[model samples]
Target: MTDSDIGYLTPVIDEDGAPFWQYAARGQLRIQACASCDELRFPPRPCCPRCRSFDSTWRRMSGRGRIWSYVLPHPPLLPGYAEQAPYNAVVVELADAPRIRLVGNVVAAADAPLDSVDPELLSVGAPVRVAFTAASGGVTVPRWLLER
Candidate 1:
């Protein structure tokens, strides 16, 4: 990876999130869905909060959402994200799950600098959609931006 390249180094899949990451590697966005109540959840887990059932499935999402909240960090950022300071990180409300939201980075384009989006462009309730970014190790991450 080059110094200017900004992205996750390796697949960070935990015990509960392994399936989600594995699916994302194939250009799919899989989120946890409660088998009982049919509730959609992000950041996969073993048990559903709504139904409290261990039974869940990997459901593909439309990859479309609206910007719910955003933050442009000051100079200091947490570890790996520090290099991309001033970047807009947002919580996106998926249309599929009006109550659930996913966190993602709002960027200009796939090839554009990760930190290039100006703060003026971001606003609450902005319409945004997911774009799966291809990366090494057969990983595809959902990067967000204004829907075109």
Candidate 2:
């Protein structure tokens, strides 16, 4: 089935997180970095959590990471996610910035379905690399692929 047929949820981009989506559209992975302390932050907050600095910059990442954790969603799924049940949602810790982790799905390729990868293959600390998929509403999301 096509992506639209699966009815994937699109991210709600706000002022603080707009840059993150924009970078993803350009096939780049960036995180909010505190201008003062140079600490990277996730979820795109306005101020730095470490130093409480409002001034921040978008820093490009290496797009390489290791799986920190994961979950396989069961029944009672959300409206658009039921068809993709048994899919794995992973938390990946960036190789360059261990403290910064990103949540995403692990697929075989950029356009693969959420449940493309065998669930039995997923493991914590498994090396992964980034892949981008263009979702609805002109947004590009970063997904993960198992590194061979």
Candidate 3:
């Protein structure tokens, strides 16, 4: 696997979140769900916040979402992303789970630089689809592509 050129920070995978990353490696967007309550959640945890159950499962999302909000950072806070300044970081609300939002960069294509898309092109409620890119340490990170 090759690391993305943007050098974006890698996600810290924990026991509860491993499955999500595993699915992403295969280009699937899976979210953690409470087996008991049937509620979906992100930033996976061992216990369901709603039902307080230890049983959990992963649900594959449609990979479809809307850009709930976005920002083009003038000077990226992270040093590694400095070269990719003016790139967009978007919060996408899943079409299947509106309350489950994911934060990621919107690029022109999978593996494209963070700033690949023009900042002026982004807007709230813009349609987007999930794209995965290999990042440092054999981890795949999710990015977004504007659905045009």
Candidate 4:
């Protein structure tokens, strides 16, 4: 798909996710590593999910993972995602975490719908990794995929 399809990637840019996007623009995948317990967190937050420590550092990730859970959005789902109905919204278990999960999309196009990836090719525990796409104002953010 063309870049025109990646229209809704506007990251809210709150305290947590801003740095992650900043790094993504440079083609780096970042995850929050807790300074206290050394746990890696995703969906970006200040505190570590393990130790609940406010101290953390942004660690560059290997950008590799496996599908932990997933779903196909169907008719009568979230209206914004209806056009992309049957799109896969998956929770991936980062290789670094194995226990921690990151929710993202699985599509042929970074911004395309779940339908872009044939359901036959998707399954729990499938290999996946982080990918990036252009976003508003020339920024970039992470998207998920079945292949590199």
- Scanning candidate 4 in windows of ten residues, the lowest lDDT window is 1-10
On residues 36-134, what C-alpha lDDT tens digit does candidate 2 reach at each position? Answer: 999888889998888888999999999999999999988725657777777899999999899999999999999998889999999999999999999
Q: C-alpha displacement of 46 in model 1, angstroms?
A: 1.0
Q: What is the Å distance of residue 126 in model 4 from its true position?
A: 0.5
**Candidate achieving the largest lDDT:** 2
Candidate 1, 44-109: lDDT as tens digits: 788888879998888888888899999887764455567777787789998777777888788888
Listing every candidate in turn, what is its Cα RMSD in Å to the true structure after a full C-alpha superposition?
Answer: 3.7, 3.1, 2.9, 4.3
TM-score of each: 0.81, 0.90, 0.92, 0.77
lDDT, residue 6, model 4: 42
Q: Rank order by TM-score, top first? A: 3, 2, 1, 4
lDDT by residue (tens digit), candidate 4, 10-93: 456677878887898898988878888887777778777788889988888788999988887655344456666667778888
CA shift of 130, model 1, Å: 0.6
* Best-to-worst lDDT order: 2, 3, 1, 4
Give the TM-score comparing model 1 with the true structure, all chains together: 0.81
Alpha-carbon lDDT, every model: 0.76, 0.90, 0.89, 0.75
Q: Which candidate wins on TM-score?
A: 3
1 versus 2: better lDDT goes to:
2
Name the regions of candidate 2 deviating beyond 4 angstroms. 1-6
